[model samples]
Structure formats: C-alpha cells, structure tokens
Target chain A: MKPEQKPDQQTLSSTFALRINGADLVILVLTIMLLFWVYNRLWFKQSSGKADYLVVQIDTQAPVQYPLNQKRLLELEGRKGKSIIEISQGKARFIHSACRNQFCVFHGWLSTPGDTTACLPNRISIAVKSHSVKDTEHFDALAGER
Target chain B: MQLHFTTRHDDHRIALLAALAISIHIIESAFPSPLPGIKPGLANVITLFCFIRYGWQTALQVSLLRVLISSLLLGSFLSPTFLLSLSGALLSLASLYIVQWPFRQHLKYQPTAIGYALIASISHICGQFLVAWYFFIPHPGLFKLLPVFITFAVLLGLLSGIITQLLINTDTAKI
Candidate 1:
C-alpha cells in the first residue's frame, strides 16, 4: 500500500475503534444522577400554604399590608412620584412606577411566600409575607442564603 | 485523478451541513422542554462531526451558521435568547478546541467523543448561566436552576456522544 493511503487507514481504524469508554460513561452517569437528586431537592419538592399578605413599604414610612384574598389597585407615593401596584388572583405586581429604570415594574408578580419586588430608585418594595414564622424564616429571612 | 478539496467545495459542504444543523435546531426548539434551559442540543452533533473530519475553522463556521440562521428563523435574532445561544455555542467550541490541543501537538493523548461532548456541554451551560445572571436577571436567584441545567447537560451530552459515535461507525458517513 502506498504511504498516501496511510491517512485513510488511520481514519478507518479510528472510526472502527470508537466507542463509549467505561470510565467516561460512569462519570457521566454519576454526574447526571447526582445532579437530578440535587434538582429534585431544590425545586420539584412541594411545600404548603399561600402568602398571607402583600406588604408594601415606601421609604422609611410604615409598611402597608394587603390581604392576598383581595384584588385591588394601589396608587402609592414613591421617591419618583406616583407608583402603581396591582394585586389579583393571589399575586402582587409592581405594574407601573415613575422610576427611570423600571426594574421593579419589570419584576412581574410576587405570588409565593418569599417572593419580593423592589424599586431601588423609588425607594419602594413589596414582599409576600406568610403569617407563620417558620414559613417566613424559611424563605424571607434567608436573605444571605441564596 | 487528483482530488482537489478546493475552497468552493469547502464552502458548499459547509453550507449544506449548516442547513442540516439549522433544521435540526429548529425542530428541537419546537419541542416543549420539560424544564426551562434544558435542550437536547442535537445540532452539536454536526459540529463534532465537522471538527473531527475537517478542522476547527469548519466546525466554528458550522456552529455560528446554525446559531445565526436558526435564530433568525425562530424570530429571536438580536434578542436575549439569541445572546444566550451565541454565548453557549462560543464556550462549547472553545472547550472542544481545548480538548483537542494535545492531539494537535502530536501528543499521544486523544479525547474521545464522550469526553469532548461532556466538556463542551458543561461549558455551554456555564456560559449561558453567566450571561443570564449578569444581563437578563442580575440576581443570585438564577442560581436556583443551576443543578437542573447541569443535570440536563450531562444527560444530553452523553446521549449526543453516543449518537455521534454510532454515526462515525457507519459506512455511509461522509467522513
């Protein structure tokens, strides 16, 4: 056989020999198994109860509470003039605000016990606070946890 | 007869492969994912095949072409989704190239498809995660999906590797 044909021979041999090796297969399997376990622990498992209230706080003033069962539109004052919050179907959202960035308005809704939306520029924030201390601490007080 | 693999042939082959990859990408995207940020990434099979048969440049061209053309077809070009896809492709390509460095140097070490695929998949997810955190969400809360994304990557990477290996073993493969 000519030397020019050696490259083709090598390629053929390489292709014929290609298979999933044991070590790599085992690693992949183990990694995937471990990751699935972690994912289930973090997200898939369920907890009970809904949020008790939507707590809206502006600046240093007292926090305002709205029961989750009630659906209403709140027009509140913020550092950047008027801000609008809407609560419906057990969810609260910062729908509109005068802040330039509109970060809070884009945050969508706070439905879960620990969900939160804050407008830093407007010095306004909303938190879904559960009445039970255990539930509250599990999500809300774990500020540095994430 | 002298077989001249000219630039025109290369260009035509690249275009054909890109079309194949783009079709696969779009079809996969149409399937509803079980979880957010999880994808089978079957298109990377074409990239791996190109890298092994042609070279890094061809592989890069195929990948970028797939991303660009597919995103345009999906109506997500220049959007955050497009940015995420671009970043993921770049990082995976970088990882594939890194794994092949030793072979390029005439070293005895050679990474198999499984190894390359695993590394590329993990890097792809990491790249997308970082981009999502830094630009789209800008919050640590995004980390909540890390484990899910990573698990999917490993599973999908291994799957793609097996598929590529099977294809390479076939007699009909152009390579």
Candidate 2:
C-alpha cells in the first residue's frame, strides 16, 4: 500500500475499533446495573429489632460491663480533659464529653446489631449485638447469669 | 474500489461504535463512588467521538441508547433512577452539541473535548436536580447541594476528557 493510502487505512480502522469498543462498553454497563438492581431489590434485607447485648469497651485493657436496665444503661463524662465511662442505663455511652464532634451524644441509642453510634473525637464507639428470639436457650443462659 | 468497499461497510462500523459506547458505560458504572449518584460518565468519551466523527445525531443516539440499555440492565428501568439517567444523558448530549458547534472552527480536538465535557457535566447535574425536584425529592432546599455536585462533576468531567483526548491523540499519532 502507498504511504498516503496507509494513513487513510489507519484512520478507518481506528474509527471502526473505537465504535465497536463503545457498543461493548454499553452492554457491559447494562448487565452489571441489572444484576445490582435485582440483587438489591430481591436479596438485600435490612435487619430489624433491638440488639440483645450492648458492648462498650473503654480504652483500658479490660472491657467494662454494665447490667442491662430499662433506663440509664451507659454514660461517658469528660472530666479534667479525661473521658470517664459511666454506665448509667445498665449500658455505656457518652453522657457528657468535652470532645468537639459530640458524635457519641448524637448517636442516641443503638439497641440492635449493625447499629453503631460513635464519638470520633473521643475515640469512643457504642454498638449493639443482637440475639434472635428463636435463640431462647442462649438468651436464658446470658440473662440467668444476670 | 476495494478500499471504498471495506470502509463503507456499515455493519462493522456501527456495531463497533455501539459496542464501544456500551462498554464504557458499563465500566463507568462498575467503578464504585463514595458519593451516591455520582458517575464519571466514562461512556461519554465514545459519545464525544461520535460527535466528532459522525454528527450530533449519532452522538445523541449513542448516548440515549447507552442510558436505556444500562438502566434496563442495572434493573433501574422505569424507576426514578432510570429517569435520572435519561435526563442526564439528554442534557449532556444537548450541551455537547451546543459547545461542539461554536468552537468547531477554532478549537483543537483536546480543547473541544474539554469544553464539551465541562458543559455535559454541568448539564448532567442540572438534569439530576430537575429529576430530584420533580419525582422524589420535592424540597427546594436540595438546590443547596448544587455547588458540591457541580464541583464533583467538573472534576470527573475533566478527568474523562483528558483520558479521551489521550486516546484520540494516540490514535491520530498511530495513523
């Protein structure tokens, strides 16, 4: 082929290639989107119900435990620039903190698994662990100890 | 005669264009984003190519077809999400066509790519806002987020344009 013809040939080929690539890209995107939508619609189920256990671990080597009561489970207070963990509602959370974010306070009550309230400034996390009602034996084992 | 016959074959060219465009769309969507409803619009590179190579009509057709196919595949068809995609695609096409027109004479390929990309990004955001206002989110207060959305759009659009420009430049050089 002549040099002049070569440039035109290349251009034609590139154009064809780019066009094919575009079409394939569309098909792939559509397929993925469809799968995601179907999965989200049919399979992704949000959990419901309060957590059975609320675990609050302070910065210490050992985890502090509080009894579960209807009210005043957990509370944290800021004293002299130190975070004080106070379990008031038989659980623990920040009752008062000097931290700027106050994220823990806003976290409110997380009474179920997959629920978490955190105070990032204070490096505090309040989370709930759930036990199913069907697990009555396990529930009794834990509750009996209390 | 042989060269003319090979180049004029419509099936090969059209199929290739459609496939490429769709593939870009898929890739863009597949890449995860931190922010919900934000996309790089990777497929738009093909639309830009179409705009340059074919015409506005072909570009529009490719864009709309990509949106429809992607939405249906993603299972967002006939949903609020589909509407958002459709509106965004239309708006982007309009912007691409508009910008491509006035500057076609003076601007080089890269600059034209950049200009059209920015316009498309802005138009996409506006389309999203309109959809939000009409269908799901009726609150006028949602407009407050426009600046943040636009900023993200600009960044994404620029990146996309740069990549497309690189590809086109490479192709030109090879030719």
| 10 residues in a row with least lDDT, candidate 2 chain A | A133-142
Docking class of 1: incorrect
Candidate number with greatest DockQ: 1
**CA shift of A84, model 1, Å:** 23
* Candidate 1: tens digits of C-alpha lDDT, residues B21-120: 9999999999998877898999988888787667799989999999999999999999888999999999989977876885696533555677677877
What CAPRI grade goes to candidate 2? incorrect
TM per candidate comes to 0.59, 0.50
Share of reference contacts found in each model: 0.23, 0.00
lDDT of 1 at B159: 82
What ranges in model 2 sit over 4 Å off?
Answer: A1-146, B1-11, B103-111, B172-175
Among these predictions, the greatest lDDT belongs to 1
List, residue by residue over A1-146, the lDDT tens digit for candidate 2.
75556777776566544222332344335434644554454346443544455666554434444444444523453232445444434344556666877666666555434455655565555565545533222222113422
How high is the TM-score of chain A in each model?
0.66, 0.48
For this target, which candidate reaches the highest TM-score against the unseen true structure? 1
